[model samples]
Target: MAYTGEVEVGGPPDVHELTDLIITKAAVGPMDNNAYVLRCRATDEQLLIDAAAEPHTLLEVIGADGIGAVVTTHRHRDHWQALAEVVAATGARTYAGRLDAPALPVPTDVPVDDGDTISFGRIRLTARHLVGHTPGSIVLVYDDPHGHPHVFTGDCLFPGGVGNTHDDPAAFTSLLTGVTAKLFDVLPDESWVYPGHGRDTTLGDERPHLAEWRERGW
Candidate 1:
């Protein structure tokens, strides 16, 4: 991949520390949406998470050398507008949630729903069905070859916020209760959270904010 700007910026978290798990954030599109690249250094395997915008920027970071697959978080344009462009670049297959199939550009080769795992070399990513922002929204969890477990949350949950509400009030409520009961209830407090935008955070930092989020009816 070729990037016009530095792939690593801000230097808040040492890139070397995350060497085993190569994660690069690219600001794609005019909305400045983030498209992430997750690579297993041990195997040089890569997965592009959320091909929403900025195909060139994302490609630059992942490079043209190695890309195993591309995973979409939801159906929103900010989450998948550049998917077709990405697939064309690396010949990588994409995985989308079943409910998001209708919004995908090419539905023929896409994988639907959850409980499916995409593995590259020694890295295995388990897809969890996390519906909130969309009925098909999912969270990808994996244990890097180096032994740290990380979760790619998409837009489901953010550092100081949650995904926006859906049209139906009942659906929004379900999204909240479902995730809080299923995902957040079981994951470790220290688990790392990589949202679709902004900075990375730990579950510990977000736990307290859940109450306020729920109170605000988000």
Candidate 2:
């Protein structure tokens, strides 16, 4: 079947192929958190984004090839519930946004800042820091040489609007500003957005609603 980017907990993952990379997205945990397994086609080196839950399931998806690194998108418990177990099992190094690194259950091997690169095999993802969802929430961007760019947005950008800010105007403003400048303004509308939970969306699909999102203040 074609990749639809829609997954359910306990269901099969949706897989997409790129020129040098293969992305496998799975939904795990009661919260329905999304975990992405990226494999480099040339070297087969694997990197996991968010070991959210169900270590056994994640490990199974990883297979015997093993993973080289795990990157937690933020400090949220739901996003890293299985971090310790997965890391312990695969002996994978951990990476997170510098500001949110101290709060994770596992030690962050690399505290990343904006513009830092996370690499596995021949592929690299650029980290873009977007504040307000958390002090250091980040989205990973893979500028595919063969196709449109793909981004892994961790609890920051979703299908309808930005992440929840609990009604705090300042926080909402900060998130919206960062998302607009760093994401919408920079990336092309064809860029694919892989969010932390639920289904995926593209920049083109959400761009027109920026004003509405700002006015609604969510």
Candidate 3:
């Protein structure tokens, strides 16, 4: 999709497959929040993550494709600024962790708890509740049958350290603890990290510096 200078829409209009899943990515809003479309090739059911901004572009990116659900990674306004618009346009059910669901502008059809499994077609994503950035912040883990795992961390685990803690020591500890235990310790080093904003990174690239991140403390 050609989005011109304002927004960069990367991925095929038809389908971009990774193993049995098809993924589409678009960077939207001034903040450049990533909006992802994940499809199960076997059934074509799709789940959209973070409809940050640019309703027209988001709706267009979704195109004629039917959306099974929309998940907002957290309660942050930047992440779901365009959520109401997208849901209105597509009629897709909305989901977020129970702790964070109350924060959204729209209603949630499903309150995703940690370890909750969301399945469509042959694709299954397990929700990992990683707190700190937000009380109910979640990371979706997809164990790709073909290769390594794929974890979509909203704003928790970035390429550098954990997501910004804004000098809140307690919050930082909460977020980093989740990242270290729930993510780093459990997931493989080869796990692909799809963040809420900016580019993607791998658990392998950010793991070795855990001690460094802890000592400095954001």
Candidate 4:
């Protein structure tokens, strides 16, 4: 089937194959959180983004290859519900934004900051920090040499608008500003966005609505 990037809880994952990487996205937990398993085609080394929930399902997806690292996108509880179990089972190293690391259930082996590079096998992801939903929310960017860049947006950027800021104007502004400068400005429109939940969208698809999101002040 085509890679639509749409997934449902308890259903099969949607797999998107790149030149050198294989991205398998699955929706887990009652909240329908999306967890991505990125496997490097060259080495078969895998890295999981957002353990979210359903350790058994995640473990099944991981299989016998085992995971090398797990990254928690932010400090939100829903994002890391299965962190402990996943880590305990796979013994994967944990990575999260420095500011949000301490709050996570598992100890962060690598406390990342903006511009930090996370490597697993031949694949490399650049961590970009965007504050708003949480103080240390981050999105991982993989600039594929064979194709357009792909981003794993935790709870930061979604299909329609930015993540929730709890109606705080300052927070909303900060998030919007970071998103604009770090993402929209730096990346190309064709960049594929894999959000933390719901369906996927392209940067081109959401760029025109920036002002509207600002005016709405979500």
What TM-score goes with each of the models?
0.85, 0.99, 0.92, 0.99
- Candidate 1 structure quality by residue, lDDT tens digits, 1-218: 43222233322222323646667666565665667777777888888888877676667777767587888888888788778888888888778888876777866256656678877656777887877678888888875555556788888877776777765666667777766775678777777777777667777788878778777787
lDDT of 3 by residue, 11-41 (tens): 3333345879977778876786888889888
- Model 4: lowest-lDDT 10 consecutive positions: 129-138
**Total residue pair clashes for candidate 4:** 0
lDDT of each: 0.72, 0.96, 0.85, 0.96
Tens-digit lDDT string for candidate 2 (49-165):
999999999999999999999999999999999999999999999999999999999899999999999999999999999999999999999999998999999999999999988
lDDT of 4 by residue, 90-163 (tens): 99999999999999998999999999999999999999998998999999999999999999999999999999
Clashes of 1: 6
| Candidate 3 Cα outliers beyond 4 Å, as residue runs | 1-16
Cα deviation of 102 in candidate 4 (Å)? 0.8
After TM-score superposition, the amount by which residue 36's alpha carbon in candidate 4 deviates from its true location, in angstroms, is: 0.2
TM-score computed on alpha carbons, candidate 3 = 0.92
